[model samples]
Every structure is written in C-alpha cells, then in structure tokens.
Target: MKDLSTFFVKDNLDEIVFSNRNKAYGAYALRNEYSSQLTKALFVGVAFFASVAVIPLIVSAFSSDVITDKGHDYGPYILDPVEEIPEIVKVTPASSVPVKVKTVESTIFTPVRDVKKNKPLPTEDDKKDAALSSETSAGEDTKLIVAPPAIKVGPPTVAPPYTPPAKVEDPNIVVDGTKVDVAADFKGGINAFREKVAQNFDTESVDKTGMVSGVITFVVEKDGSISNLKVTGSSSEFNSEAERTVKAIKTKWTPAQLKGKAVRSSFRMPISMKIE
Candidate 1:
C-alpha cells in the first residue's frame, strides 16, 4: 500500500507540471500575437502617412517639370530672344528728270466794221426836213425787211380717269359660272377663314380617323362673292371634313384689279384638318 501511494503521488506531480507549462506557452503565444498586431498596425499607419506625403511631392516634381517644359514651348521664355532681331535697311529711290511740254498757236478770223463820218448840223427848218426824210427812208427799209413764218404747237392729250367695275353678285352658294371678287368676296381674310374652320371643326372626327390637307381653288367676283369652289388636292382620310369645311367658309375677299379697274379674279386656298 505504501508503494502504490508513492507511484500515484509521482504521477500527480508530473500532471501539474505539464499543466503549468501549457499555461505558460499560451500566455507567450498571446503576448506574441498582440505584439505582431501592434507592429502591423504601426507599419500600416507609417505606409499610409508616407503615401499621403510622397504622392503630392511626386506630383509636384512632375508638375514642375511639366511647367518648365511648357514655358520652353508656349510661354514667354521662347519669345524673349525674338525681339532682338536687327531691322532691315531701306534704300531711297533716285529722283526722276522733268520733261517740257510744247505749246501750239492757231489763227482766228474776226470781221471789223469801219466807223462812218458824222453829218454836219443844219438849221431848224433843215433839221425838220431831214427828220421827215429819215422817217420816209425808215419806212421804206421796214418794207424791205422779210419776216419768218410762224410755227404752230398742238395741245397735249389727257388720259381718261379709271373707273372700277361693278361687283358681280353670286347667284348660287356653289358659285358656278359667275365671276367673283377675290379680295372683296372674302368677308374675313384668310386668317378669319382659318379661325372659323378651326373653331367649328370637329376634333373627334379627325382624331378618330386621321388628318387631311387640300388646296381649294375658287373665284371671287367683283361683288364679294365666292364661285368655282373646287379642291385641287386632298388626303383621303379627312377629305370629306376638308371639303365640308371649305364649302362652309363664306369668306369675302377684295376683288382683283385689272387695268386699274376692279375685276373678278381666281384665288387658291389651302384647307387642313389635324386630329389631336
């Protein structure tokens, strides 16, 4: 029994030593892990600071070189020496000799009249007799003088005043044969016709189907009336609507002028229908 107790006691001591060594190793491992983590954190912090500081310095160095090169190519550095070039010499031209021009002389003919000698003065009776004789001689000279024929001028002809033709009234709504006034027949202008058509037009009729555009030709008589209503062209979709609207339009337009007189003239109107 004593020997068995001794063996048990030895085994218990060995177990306690192994347990203590394991705990010491665990503590060392924990310390080494903490130290490693701290070292890594410090290294990371230093690298971050170095990158932030060095990147700007690197960019600054490259930027400085770029600025220097730019100055060499595009800045005032390349222009400073260009202002020192020597000016070119200009030579003066020699004076030209003057040339003399010659003058020519021409003869002109003029008639000269000789002066007659004055007659001696006579007595009063003699002077009266001379005056009567001179009067008879003047009358004889006047009879010898010949007169030129008279020229006749005719009076200028005047043009007749212009009178506007009477306005022709349209007998039928369709206005088939009667001549109509284009400007006077259309009561409202083109703008009025467009407004009326737009106001009365059925949007549903067009929108449900489509749109149609057509050119209508009609004559306006001297008497503010529309005639010869006909569609020149139209789209098939809204042709009926366009025709109806055009027929409904009772536009009174101004009659056309011919040779300064108001006359019936043809007018072309465009009708369009659009669906919203």
Candidate 2:
C-alpha cells in the first residue's frame, strides 16, 4: 500500500505545475481565445467619428430658426388711383342675391270692451235700484258710495338714459413700467425705426451659427426723449452689441399719453441679430 508521505512528495508537485508554458490554465485560455485587440480599436474609432459628425448637423438645423430678428412693418405703401377695383355689374337681378330681409314684429296688448249680442233686459227690482242710486244727491256722504281708483295716464316720460361717466385713466399709473392708455410709439412708426437700426448698427461681429435672442428695454421719458437703456438675454456675447444699437437711437419717441397728458413709459423690444 502507498503511504501518505508519497502523495505529498515535492517531485509529484513539480511535475503537475511546471510541465509546459505554451498551454494556459482553463480560465486564461478561454479569455485569450475570445478577446481581439483589433476589433476593440475599430469600435472605439467609429464611436468617436460619429459623435464629431453629429454635432455640426445639430448646430446647422437649430441655427436656421435662431437667425430671425423682429420684422419691420411696411404700411407706407399706398395703392394708386389706377389700382382701384371698380364695383362689379350684377350678373343676375338684385333679387337673385339671397337677402335676409328682417320682418318688423310688434305685439301690442290692447284691452277689448265686448258687448253681449243677447243681453237680457233689466228686471223690475234692478230698475228700482238704479232709480234709487240716481236720486241720491252729489253732496251726500253715504256708506254705499265708492269712488273709482285714479289711473296714471300715458307712459311715464322715459327719464334721459343714465350715462356712466367715461373711464378716466390716470396718467401717473404705470403698469409693468408702461401706460395702458396710448402706448409708446417711435416718431415715424416701426418702419422708420427698422431703417435707423440697419443704417447705424455694426453687424460684422455677430454670429450666424446659432440664434441668440436678447431684449433691449428703455424708458421713453415725458419730454419725448429716451432714457434707462438696458440689454438682457441668454447669450452674454451679444449683450454689448444690443446695448449699443438701442443707445444709438437718438430720435425722440412720441411719449405715451394717459388722460391727455404725456407720461414716462417703458418698452420691451426683442432683438434678433441675423445675417440677412
């Protein structure tokens, strides 16, 4: 029989552990067979290029919507006399056009006094009673005498319709720094305002890649002069430019009026800087 010391011998341990370097352990061999260095590198390169290409496309799509600034009004173009449209001659009779003729309706209630066709003649007792009543004197203060109720004649003269006093807006009142009555307006209207901006503003530094919305708020003082100019928005890069554009408008505005008096008014104007 083999002894326990023989199984624990150093020679047996060396033969099992240090036999070969080429053949790996079971777990190591499985991992080395499945993994590939070239495959991993290819996957990483594709992901990097995909992310870089997608960014510029997103910017271009969003930039189109952002480039729009507040538009100008073109109300000064009036039609000439030659452009007037004359009235059309009726093809059919005037009666052919379906006219919704309104009918006048009046429902007046009138009391009717009817006389019986077959009234019976008065009896002898009724005749006697009528005679007795007629015989009574006008000066008599008898219990049987009853006076008829006095009736008011004709419709009471309709008193002049009560008119509420006109709503008087106080000029001093400022709602969100603005007057509710006659709002503030540029001297020559919106078109004139746009022309002034285009002629004066410096557009070289403005970016066209993305939309940067901002607001230029200013107070139109009582003397038809502008003051308190400010610029605010999400992008600070354009704030200085917006401030410069609004301040350049040296033209006096028509001051807002409330209660027939000029008042200091605040205006919030949106500034959209786009490459036109």
Candidate 3:
C-alpha cells in the first residue's frame, strides 16, 4: 500500500532474472551493457553512411570546372559583283581562199645508141666524082648509130682458156686393206676365193711354170666390183693368167668399211701353182 506506482523499479527481464544469481558471469555483464552498445553502434553506422554520401558533394563545390559555350563564330558574308561582257563581231570573205603556187621540174632528153652499122660501098661513078675521105658522114634518122670496127689483117690475139684447179683428193677416201676397220672380203671368204682362183687358173698358158707363186693386188670398189688389178711375178704370162683367173670370178665382194661407211680398199692375195 505505499504508492508502488510512484516507486517504479525499472529492471529489465535479463537483470531481473539474473538478480543475485552470478552477475559476475560474462553473459550477465553482456546482457546488462547491450542497450548502451546498441546505441553506440547505431550512431557510428549513421555517421559512416552520412560521410560516404556527403564527400562527393563537398569535393565538387571546391573544384573549378569551367564550362564555356562551344558555338562557332562566323563572319558576315560578302558577295562579289559580276561584270557583263560584250559580244565580238567577225567578218569573212565570200570567195574561196587562194593556195600557194608550186614550181614544176623539167627533164633533159637523151638519145639511145644503136648497134654498129656498115655503110654502103661507093659506086664507080660516085668514086669518080667525089674523092674518098675518112671524114664521118651524117647519121640516119634512126637512133644514134656507130660505125663498124675495122677488120684486122693477121690472126687476132685470143685470151687463154680458163684451166680449172686440180681436184683435191678426198680425205674420207679409200683405205688400204691393212688400214680399214673391216677388211674387204670375198663373198665366201679369202680361202674360198683362193680355191676358186686355183680352179679357174690356166696353168698350160704359163711359161716354165713350176709351183708358180705370185701376189695379186686389186681394189674392192664402193660398188663391190674389183678394180685396179695388178700382179707381180717372175713370168709375165703367169701374171697375165693369174689376173684373168681372178677376173673370171664374177662374185661381188663385201666392201671394206672405215667408220662404218663402205669404202674402196686395196686387197692382196698370193697365188701358187704347178704346171708339170
């Protein structure tokens, strides 16, 4: 009954619950200072937010950023005045214009000459009346004529006839049998050719022929015909008979070759016989 309302004991629930029950504990102390801590944190938060919002405004007010008008300045236009020109008058002649005169060249006339002509012989009557003279007579109306030349009495001198130079022997020429790449050979062979010669040779025609031995030489022509036939031996008749026997063999030969080309080549063969 003693004015309990007027004596209002303001004790929070945490304080009232912790009354005389270990107020020294950390939880109790934290509970008691919670209101003061909350008020201090609120004031600090408001100051931080206010400073953040006002810093840009404070810097802009002190900075000098001058803004000038960017419009271009142009001068007043001055137009140039145009002057009028008068038309020119021209005069032309009604007649055609004359051209310059040119000089003409003249050509000289020349007469052509004709072959020598013989004058007619004077008659006996004319010779009696007029004396013979060497003076030239008037020319005929034809082209300019010349007099005939006088004839010589003796044999006239003649230019010597041109003699042609001697022909040069061909360098790519016929070779001897020893010099040819491939020696000229008879159709069969040298032995076969010799056999034919011995068979055809006339031993009876030879003079004192006992084992007659001779060497016959001939050329194998490009056409494979025998040419330049010659024989050497003691008896002339034996030589002649040997040559005749070799000629009687009608078979052509294989021409000798030098550098793979057919060429004439000299061939030699020794012949022997007995006429007993």
Candidate 4:
C-alpha cells in the first residue's frame, strides 16, 4: 500500500518540465515504436523507384516496335545473340543487262524526183551504163550477158501483076436495077415515055379489058439504047401489049452513070388496057 501510494504521488512541473536533458523521450519513444513501419515505407519507395526505372528498360529490350495486338500477344523472353540481318541482293542475268549500242553509218533516204514532160527517160544504153557503174562500186555478183535470138531476114514476096476482072454480060441487068449517080431518063422526060407508050397502044386493035394490066421490063444499055424487052404480069394479052408498047419507044434514053461512067440500068413500064 505504501509503495502504490508513493508511486502515484508524481514529481512536480519544475522537476518534469525543467529537467536538464534536452531530448524529448516521448517523441523518441514514439519513433522507436513505429520504426518497423518507417522501414517498410522506405523499402516500398526504393522498390517503386527501381521498378519505374527498370520497367522501361525491360519493355524497350522486348519491344520490336510493332504496334498491334500482335505485339501485345508476344510474351517477354530472353533474346539470343542479336545479329544484323544481311540486305537482300537482286541479281540480274548477263542477257538481261543493257549493252552500250554502237552507232552505224547509213545512207540518208532521198525521195524520187518527178519526171518532167519535156525530159525524156534514160535509154536502154544509158540504163546499162549506170547499172554497170553501180555494180562495180557495190562489188555485186558477176552479171551474165544473154545474146538475143537471131532475126531471120525474109525476102518480100512480089504479088503477081494485078489483072482486072473480065467484063461479063450481066443477065440481071434487065431485072435488078443498078445504083447509079445519074438515073436513066427519057429523051424529053417521063411524059415522053408515057406519050410513046400511049401512041403504040392506040395502034393495038386486039380485044382487051380494063382489068388487064402488065409490066414491060427492059435494060438501058451504056449507049443510051433499050434492049432485053420482056413482059411480066397476070394477063398474057396485057403483057404482050406492054411489051409491044415498050418496043415501040424509038427515042433513046439518057443513060445512067456510075461514078461518071455510063452503066446499064433496068427500066419497067406498067400498061393498063382501058375499055370504055
């Protein structure tokens, strides 16, 4: 009891507050009690700083810089000894390589001039001479000269002396008319021919009909005289009358001419017996 009472009776303010020991034991004691916590906080800060510095190094070491899910999917791993990859080399073949071209000397093109109307073309002799000169300059192949085929000279045949065709009496001169420049004419014209025919018919007393009709055929000779008096018609009496009438014409006719020369020309006369 005595000890407990004495222990409770504490020292006064002068003894506790005004002590000579400057150190605050309360603060030192408080610090000592939380020392383990302080050491734990300090260790945490040091570990955080180390991770901040080393995390970037670790990320950079693993980063291939590929920016995609593919990069994220790749897990970190120890790298093998890094070696620089050699660049790919393309090899071109000798055939495909371009070659330096060589310049060639060639003749310039020349247009052919138009030939003038007054200028004549080169003759065969001139053409041969030019060809020979070109061949000599160009060292062309030897030319083969082919001789022309021989020309056989034949004698001109002499035509036999031209003999004119013989003049034969034209039996048709009394029938078919001849084409002449000047046609035959009566001595006094066509009226005279009819007058002579009428005069001869008036002398004929033989019986006749108005229906009786015939033609008298004759050829005027080159001498302007009538010949080959023939009769042609349906009625024989009328034919006979026409023939007698034509023969009665004593006047000579004007002969026809073929190319200014007199030619034998045929003549015809129709006769009708008028029975009034």
lDDT per residue as tens, model 4, 31-99: 444757888899999999999999999998998776665545566788799899999999887676777
Quality of model 1 by C-alpha lDDT: 0.62
Error of 1 at 202 (Å): 2.9
Ranking by TM-score: 3, 4, 2, 1
Candidate with top lDDT is 3
lDDT of 3 at 7: 34
For every candidate structure, what is the RMSD over all alpha carbons to the true structure, in angstroms?
21.6, 41.9, 25.0, 47.2
* Model 1, position 16: C-alpha lDDT score: 60
Give the winner by TM-score: 3 or 4: 3
Candidate 1 lDDT over 5-116, as tens digits, reads: 7557754655565665664566555543675789999999999999999999889887754334333455444435556678888988988888889979988989889989
Looking at model 2, the pairs that clash are: none
Candidate 3, residue 10: lDDT: 30
lDDT of each model, Cα atoms only? 0.62, 0.70, 0.82, 0.70
Residue 85 lDDT (model 2): 92
Candidate 3 stretches greater than 4 Å from native: 1-172
Best by TM-score: 3
Off by over 4 Å in 4: 1-178
Off by over 4 Å in 2: 1-178
Ten consecutive residues with minimal summed lDDT in candidate 4?
Answer: 6-15
